[model samples]
Target: MTTTQRDHPSIIQADGEYLAAIATGRFYPGVLLFRSPDLTRWEQLPHPLEQVEMPESGIVLDPDLSYVDGVYHLLYGTALSASESGFADSPICHVRAPSPHGPWSPPVLLHAKGFHPSLYHESGRSYLLWSEWDHRPGRDSFGGTWAQEFYRGTRRLTGRAHLVRGGARGARLHRRAGWYYLVAGGIAVARSPHLTGPFHPDPHGALVAEGGPGCLVEGRAGEWWLTAWPEGGCALGSETVVRAVDWAGDGWPRVGDARPATGAAAPVPPGGARVPAEPGSTARADGRLPAEPELTAPADERPPAEPEPLTHTDDFDATELAFCWQSVRRPPDPGWLSLGERPGWLRLRADESPASRHRVSLLARHQHQDCEFTVLLDAQPTHFQQLAGLIHYTDHTRWHWLHLTHHEQLGRCLAVLTSDNGQLAAPADPLPWPNGPVWLRALLQHGELRFTASADGGSWTGIGPPLPVSRGFLGVCATDLTGARLVCDVDRMSLRPLSSPR
Candidate 1:
């Protein structure tokens, strides 16, 4: 029998059973903390870093939370963010706290690149095993410091990413039956006991080299098991999977699930084949290997909390900003939109869409890759050109929209896409529906994005071309090149990511 820690976390955390992944707002990546109990059910805790700094250096990722004596130390990867991303360098930052969940100290910058760190103690000094980064010029991957070593101080470890090479991502180490094992890749594997030097990368670098279904865990049997994530994160997706790992006589790790093999290992003929390691240069002397590289990646997010029902709607009984509505990419103008005026209806006083180049009215964003997302609206325009509905967008490089605007007939709709060339017809349906009280929905699965509009909130029709969903943000927006303030009172609007079956 095997035990997998998830919902019931061994550690007691501040937030509830599952954590929420609060976006860092800007490109500053956000983190989710989980309190686990005996490696089973996990609970969410308060984030280590709350407010995103001005210039985000890098994100702290693959946070492996552990306790050293009484204080909690987290080993993680440091990452940088682009300017549009809200950061300057994106180096690896480390923060220490007296408690696992705490008034944590500031980020302790570790390295320029490198990611995913694991802390280990040898003799008396403490060290880290992190994923390495490539320093070589031109190449995008390979050869880094994914080894084992001791850290003397900030960013000063006994060794680099690859004790001798560099470039490691998912590095894991453990002593089994007195034999030491190293795992990485995201799944690369090599072994040694000394914790430094030349590693004969197992022909297969990952502990579970052949990945498919099952969680591969190295429990007591001197044996392992792997659980596969069947469909991965696509279906009612985001599900936690665990399995076992098994090994062959030659010490090879393979999968129990049937999947195609990665093209790395092909059998070449002997004699005419490349010779095995020269008996002399190959050293298995002391079980000592290289260091590990680091990684950076996301949050609480009850791994499976159904997105809260969106609060804002088409009925303007109350005036206020619904928390779910977000403004990322470009800084939003507070003056153009306000909840202080009416009650539930968000007021957008005609303003220029920082995201729009020529003349377009809409402020919205795409959240994830697949799923159903929507925003309900009602707009009052003194002039004619005005619209409110589902819009898709990301950086200035991409965008599209499906909305109902006022034409000669009162409520005319149109769908438009904007690329480097210019805005072309994308999708739109004449709801003949009033600019006020219309529900707009955007359905995006995989890559195809489409917008739908409904007058009575019952029957709906597709508005345009398969709009590309570029992970955009959604919110109430108004464009007034005409200097006309468009009061678009958003009654309710919300975005959602599909989840796996409970």
Candidate 2:
């Protein structure tokens, strides 16, 4: 199966369709949802918690999705604070909706003991599972997976929590053939005859020792698939990967050779259509066989074409910001961002410096691959405090900014400012700017970044020396460090991949 450019993906087959819930990290509109008729293709749905208030620090972690009793339940954890030691207060919250495209219920606080909360349903009862966090010195922080009775109707927990099995970083539970399988850290598996009990680890050790945490999903044909991410460093963050699963004669599950394959046959036949679950039927909830399959193509045929590259332009022609755009820590407030102020332009009133996590006005999208991000900015900064231009941002402390700011020596100028893990540096002198709207571009290729400016969008002049860096979220930003809300009008923005890496 093909991988997805999303983090901490929790997938489930619900209502005859495949639904995936993605961890949004520090971006606002928490918990992105995607729907797929067949596992090979996916389309993003509206965020479930777009209006919910998010924490100002750390990130919104593991979001798990499940379908129970004709309702879509979503469980997520928010890191309220963290230090060198570990997470100080991470609260697990729950919400539900009738459909994947949801009018979700308000979040209900579950527990603060740990994160990566997942839910398991059986025989009209539900259980909450998580990796217990123990912070005492010399103690294993994630030593065991805990399970407790969860009353979904009241949105609360009952009875005492039990240590069911060894600690799993991102624990998920699946029941098959009267045996309960506990998949953890996306690499190991444990089994037990009871829902919560003394579990036995797989004698073979880790299922896929080289992959990150993920969940197990059953295909339309009763075949099980494991979803995971690569363990090594990735420029685009942790992505969603799916691997074929086979059941051993002893009932234990094994991933293919414990390695991630570059390509594999999709779980469903090409162009297979989804068969919605019958209303009031608990068949899907209890691992019952799905209705007869509807195969649109032969099993030997190749899967659908690869998805198109992440390349698009925003002229601010629409009244609403596209779903691709996201803000840090908070949703883009209409108070500072407006498209109606000037038709065909995105009006951004600077709120606070990029370093301020509370109220940053920066809006950016994930950089899936090396591409050129260009923006047309029409701003005249009276002082260095008011700046506007393109930014390749990972977090506040690690980013490269090629902006138009006022300089004491060169009045209005373009300069490159970089922060490598909070150590700030200026790699090039400020280049004097011409007055009217200017075209700013950032070319990212082959682990190196180069900045240039153009007057008419034709002839380009280098603004800074090429700097080696990793790929990150690329977008336009305007900041007012002086606390005097300055304004910057972004006429247009475009992102396209280079023909080939240099």
Candidate 3:
């Protein structure tokens, strides 16, 4: 069966260019950006949030991108504070840039309502729509989708906030043919003549009921597509699945014919006649076929240059780190990690405890569905509880770690720890590892994780039984300890296909 792996997809077509934002936070860059000539062939663009550091224990969820009046805006939400019930108020943040690959403005707080905030522009007006949660008695955790207006220049919320639609969360807005359409939670769609009120819910109910949240994109040929994720038992992580939007005779946009997309092809807009390639022109580049361009758009709105294939592998050979390496909260401090400190090696100083959210020194890459990661660690631990090793992490809650540390009773040992929503479980006894440098390997196969270690860097020994790594895992979060300070020197860390050579 075929499936799409993109999730919480927010797409914008501006200046004849198509841009989609993928929600990736506390992993590598917070949001991953993609550009597509045709919605089918997407190319990774430079991530705008590569340097933005979200606080530890905080994560950016359901990112949205919009362009208006020459200014491009990006919005995302993060938990404002910890809550016991999993449903907590999160702050929606915004940033703007003149271009998608941008010198972006610093993040500005928009509101503390709920998650999945989206921005929409009309005629000359701007509006913010998001799910509102009510902790008050007798109200469902979610109060429903709410919206308010804002001044374009000020970027501040004005006017009273009002409920636009009821039911599911994750609100989105789009306008076509004098009618405004709203996508809620993912598949449930509604329409309204006025942007603010009186939205008409789909009588047929869910457009893609099982699908997660998504946004609408208008193709150059005037075709409307619902860029969403797979629904029902098929959904996984933040994976994305784009479905064709067909309008009923009554003018209501429906997602699909009810069935979840299983290798369903992306729909092309009418009038999307392919252009013949000319000699000496790389028109047929990156498998991206040419489509009809908006004659009304300025010349600069078209694809700039043929983008190179996005690389997930970083050798740490250069003095500077690549955008793929990210920490939980802030960008890793140079004092915590360095390439030049030890030539040909990435040195990580673990001065703070793993429990330290704000100042924790760690770096991780997003975990692919079927991949292998291997690293050589030269770690020396002096104090008990000082750990330097590999971890499969989601958030502060839900994680599994295998570390080389000094156990208070076991001296130098290798330990495994697992947490389900911050509740931890560990082996009663750690394996003795009073040896020199060791090689650690982590493999993710069908969403399960297996750990193995080698003292001589040749023969491998399994450390723990295979454990389920939740899709929520941000990636492999690791820390290093040095001297008496608990530091680990990672000579090299690599990620490759399970079938590829180690």
In terms of lDDT, the best-performing candidate is 2
Q: Write one digit per residue (lDDT tens) for candidate 1, span 329-441.
A: 22233655566676766666655543543333344432554656776777654444555445565534455656545656644544344443354543444445544477778
Give the TM-score ranking, best first: 2, 3, 1
TM-score for each model = 0.58, 0.87, 0.80
**Per-residue lDDT over 374-453 for candidate 2, one digit per residue giving the tens place of the 0 to 100 score:** 89988888899888889888887888998889998889999888988888899998889889999999888778888999
List where candidate 2 sits over 4 angstroms from the true fold: 1-4, 230-235, 257-309, 499-502
Model with the higher TM-score, candidate 1 or 2:
2
Assess each prediction's global lDDT (C-alpha) against the native.
0.45, 0.76, 0.67
- Which of candidates 1 and 3 reaches a greater lDDT? 3
lDDT of 3 at 259: 38
**Which residue pairs show collisions in model 2?**
144-167
- At residue 184, candidate 1 shows an lDDT of 55
Global fold similarity of model 1 (TM-score): 0.58
Candidate 2 local lDDT, residue 470: 70
